[model samples]
Target: MPNGGSRPIFILSEDTERERGRDAQRSNIQAAKAIGNAVSSTLGPKGMDKMLVDSMGDVVITNDGVTILDEMDVDHPAAKMIIEVAETQEDEVGDGTTTAVIMAAELLEEAEELLERGIHPTVIASGFSKAASKSEEFLEAMAEEISIDDEEMLTRVATTSMTGKRVEANVDVLADLAFRAVKQVAEESDGYSIDLDNVKVETREGGSVNDSSLIDGMLVDEDRDHPGMPRRVEDAKIALLNVAMEIKETETDSEISVTSPDALQKFKDYEEGELREMVDKVKEAGANVVLSQKDIDDIAQHFLAKKDIFAISSMSSSDIEKLARATGGTVVTSLDDISSGDLGKAGLVEERKISGEEMTFIENCENPKAVSVLIRGGTEHIVEEAERSLIDAMSVVSRSIESGKTVAGGGASEIELAMKVADFSDSVSGKEALAVRAFADAIESIPRILAENAGMDPIDTIVELRSKHEGNGKTWGIDAYSGEVTDMLDGGIIEPLPIKTQAVSSASEAAVMVLRIDDVIAAKGEEGGEGPPAGGPGGAPGGMPGGMSGGM
Candidate 1:
């Protein structure tokens, strides 16, 4: 439009925003570091908790890295990516999310120094890739094999996970429960494998944490279906049914017309006869207890009560399936298919009132593959926190058993990894060696944070750890309770090998991905007004306004 000509000339929009080269990298690194600092204080056993208040005024008090990140209202794209690192760590390993995020931020910090030295991003990324692979080798070599039957070791692993949580008061009891629950569900075909779903945790408030116990069978938050049903049945023969005890309706809409009183009476008799037949079939199955996933009709209830069957209806399908596993019962879909062979045996099926609500317990299964851990606490919040602690404990124990190896916790493993990686870095030549050494330095953040959180001088503690690791004391880690360097394994602080390995691997990958980005083009906001016209010049298709577009 310079000469008022008809020919169109494309021009960049005024609203677009962009950052190139070092500016973009600095911005992203700053965002990631900020997020890391936000969660740094909540790193170790002595770490403090963060109280996050949402827009709705709901408050969450936790030191869990993933939970805190999930609750925060992060908006920066770089910060969100860091949060994803924590999330992936949590989803894959269930713990050490804080370790992962902190390490990634530190790596970026080190990489920023390299970038300032005129080192190319690709060289830094390639060095990180090599360091990460070397770290994995160090981890596997340093790990010690653990057997699932080693209850003491497993309990130590669980205790280490719950050390800083709200359930510290009952950590011993919860740790024992978590260990037992995981072992109960662990399969040992090729190697130890645990399906965490098979270990169910049910929480109930108003009781002390010490009151929590592990059940050999499933616990259902349900009561008897009818008032006339037995409240307790000993040596119970359980029949699990997924189909409804009530009569089925037609698939499509239909009309039932009663022309006269005689026709209505005949219809009622036919319905009553069908209900009676269904009850008789259940009775013939020799089941003293009935747990149905669907509702039971009043007529069927009356018939069941007449036979003194302990019937509980309206159970969830998941609960029914779990019950089938716990009681060794087949879930029958139809009454006609129920037989003595389909019944599951339980020593007792009883309705007990807990917290003023009746809950049915199916206990004393011969050898239940699926088990329940009933968590009890004086308050709802305590119970919920205990549940979270138990979940972490369970996950760690299962992870340990599956991997069949564990390493010292409390930052011991990280120090050893750092030392080994540093030695490995010495063999490499070129500027990438400097990057690899930077990667080694980045891993020191874990032990450093652990010391700082425990009120010890981080530099002194790190120096002491390095000296111990350089000598014969490989498992020496900071003892948070005393702020002294001690053997983590001897201190009963241990973690599965996968947690540390995954944290380092994930953090390195995230750091490399972030470092490779040299340009950031952020789009302009489209709020408060209409966007650019569809297919318009300088606009994306579908009327979407064009964002800043540039390259470094």
Candidate 2:
């Protein structure tokens, strides 16, 4: 239709949508910024919480960035990219999600300014990448190396992660519990590495946060399979099972013709004998407690109770793994070859009822490699938040131990890195230098937002930070409690080194990826439903981007 009055041909379907050039950039940037701002106020210790309500009337109240993003239905592709940043940060270090998303948003914000000045998207992306690399270098140089033995430092790092959550009132207790649980499961190898899976959390309501305690072994949320079984077993020799205790049924259908009454009696006795033999094998293996990954038959339960064995059915695989580690036992898949050595040992196995729920406790294990932290609270919401807070705390603590390094928290590390990155940008010559400088400005927004959320003057905070960090005091950060600039290290505000570096690395990468786009091509579904493919309006190829020199 362009050269003259000619018939137009379509490369895509009639419902396809496309936004090209500057309009596409604006649309993507606006969407990313909107999501960034949505989670911005949940940044630091003074940040506010969000109450998310679902269609079924289920509500989740949390300030956790990943949780909030996961709950929201983000339709735009650009916004979903921001969510990925938060998810990656959470998965990598379990904290600093808000910082990562906010940085990505601010980078786009700065790139918009450059876009208005006629700067190319590629140039902005290049500058941001360079800036991000410089920031990581600066942070690595600024970090302090510590070992797993630095308990107080680890405690401070744990407390920092749970600062603004609902369980802050009992943070000290929870922090200590998290650290100890991680420490108990920490094993020394080529170097000190902790498998976070070893530290399990069990949440139950109707108790104060102070009631939270660390169990020496794994806690399973199931009672004994039958009431007649012993409530507690001392010096428990447990058999971890992957197979069921039920008698097997033939896969193919068969007809059993009982020609006489004695023949039917013989069949019943044979079935009872098979059930007795299964329980006899467990007793022969010296297993006083039985935990199975599959179901236990009613007849099998009677035999186990008659033998005074405490057993649980339908145990999850994760719990079974933890139990093996805790009890120093191996899981037996088949009953045909289980020996006394195949059993696991625990000093005591008991079934206790707490808050109307029965839970089996396999405690008093010797040299246990796995541990549990029971999280208790006054209500269900508080318990949920407390569990989330504990997870964040435990994750940070484990990260600190594994990395053997940490940084001063409370925005000190961010402002210092920003200062260093901005100065590094001076040596680069070109429009890209502006983007690099923009990266510095983008991350500095962290401290500004921190001050803002804490009810302080952001401008004053940034100015003072720049002054103090000019030639000295890199560890100085805004003290929300006192509303003044103070040394974070001296104030015991610390964070794992990986969290900060991962945040900057991921945020900048996501920003660069978002910046490199000049066109958005979308296609509608067969039913013409709205989704990421519906980001832009349906249109023709005639709306091609304007920056190209050749015809399409």
Best by lDDT: 2
Q: What lDDT is reached at residue 430 by model 2?
A: 92
lDDT at position 458, candidate 2 = 98
Candidate 1 residue lDDT tens string, 107-176? 9999999999999999999999999999999999999999999999999999999998878989999999
**Every candidate's lDDT:** 0.87, 0.88
User: What TM-score, over all chains together, does every model reach?
Assistant: 0.93, 0.94
Candidate 1: regions farther than 4 A off = 1-14, 528-552
Q: Runs in model 2 with CA error above 4 Å?
A: 1-5, 525-552
Indicate the worst ten consecutive residues by lDDT in candidate 2.
Answer: 543-552
Clash pairs, candidate 2, are none
Q: How does model 2 score by TM-score?
A: 0.94
Decoy 1 TM-score against native: 0.93
Expressed as tens digits, the lDDT of each residue in 72-152 for candidate 2 is: 875567778989999999999999899899999899999999999999999999999888887888998999998888889
